[model samples]
Target: MKAVLVGILVGLATASPVSLHRDPWDPTIKLPSPTQQLVWGDVNVLHTTDIHGWISGHSKDVYPEKSWSGNFGDFYSFVTHMRQKAMTKKSDLLLIDTGDRRIGHGLTDHIFDPKKANGQDA
Candidate 1:
């Protein structure tokens, strides 16, 4: 039992940083581009959904939640840097976001000041 636990911990510790999604480095792997004449057996796709407006990440210093402490600003910076690096390496990469633009959180719910309640800019 102890050996199994240790193995699991070691395995997790060395996992790749990239998720199962499109490896931002795939295009630079020297593989031929997909062609009409050739068929591929397997492909990988990654999806992130139901993000809501949690772009700023949970502010509360809670466990697990705090693990994803990256806010939208951090995400934006990360994507920008990744895209630039991919471009330099001639890699094909795509970044996408799902729907649900608004209607949550104090910022959205408190569109108008509760004291005013007249749609006036506070």
Candidate 2:
């Protein structure tokens, strides 16, 4: 466990020094990408909150939105890599997701009660 913790600490140390910048064409928009080595520390944690069923990731088909898009698959890969690193040094790395779930999405939102003849378009 200590070994794992140490690994996690090392990975954490190398993470989080991402560059946050806006597109020159669109200053209102922002993009986040790791650009340098992160500061090391004794403890580290990763938490995700207020995500409304967007695990599928940002859309690339849509214009101007693909710049910062990364899907659940990518996220899993990152976590797995971190886990491997953590296992090496027996360090600790906790990931928490406070999901809002899928409620306002298109398919669910379009669900109409067609069972009754009450008439609502799905």
Candidate 3:
């Protein structure tokens, strides 16, 4: 009975590695699109805050993480597209970043000198 249990444990341990063959970085995965059409008014405001320098975005293939995919470039493209739409419609589109642009992720952490605290790189 002990030998059977030992063999089962060994088999489980060996099979555990196979189950862990999932890739964290899937390049083929696309970012999700908006489900519903947005109702744009004369004055449209796009607000972004507390980014903490996470420009690369969440790459995990999980629930909330997958929902928030797309990096800074993707966001910029989206803003550009919206701006174009607003221009064609003669509407005012405002993009606002309410502070907190530094000191959180790897992109904004430890990259500057000790003198720079608030992303002031001279």
Best by TM-score: 3
The TM-score, computed over Cα atoms with residue i paired to residue i, of candidate 2 is 0.46
Question: For residues 7-85, could you state the per-residue lDDT of candidate 3 as single tens digits?
Answer: 9999888874444333335667565699999888999999987776468887677755675677899989999999999
C-alpha TM-score for every candidate: 0.42, 0.46, 0.52
Residues 1-122, model 2: lDDT tens digits: 99999999999998988656444346675655889865434455677665544568776644446654766788789889877777666778888865432333322333633233233332
lDDT per model vs. reference: 0.57, 0.61, 0.74
- Among residues 3 or more apart in sequence or in different chains, the pairs in candidate 2 whose N, CA or C atoms overlap within 3 Å are 3-89, 3-90, 4-89, 4-90, 4-91, 5-90, 5-91, 5-92, 6-91, 7-89
Instruction: List model 1 lDDT by residue over 6-111, tens digit each.
Output: 9999999998786454333345646557777422223322245556556778786654566567777887787777666666666655665543323233333346
The per-prediction CA RMSD against the true structure, in angstroms, equals 13.5, 20.4, 7.0
lDDT assessment of candidate 1: 0.57
**Reference-based TM-score, model 3:** 0.52
Those runs of model 3 whose alpha carbons end farther than 4 Å from true positions after fitting are 1-37, 101-122
Those runs of model 2 whose alpha carbons end farther than 4 Å from true positions after fitting are 1-36, 39-42, 60-64, 101-122
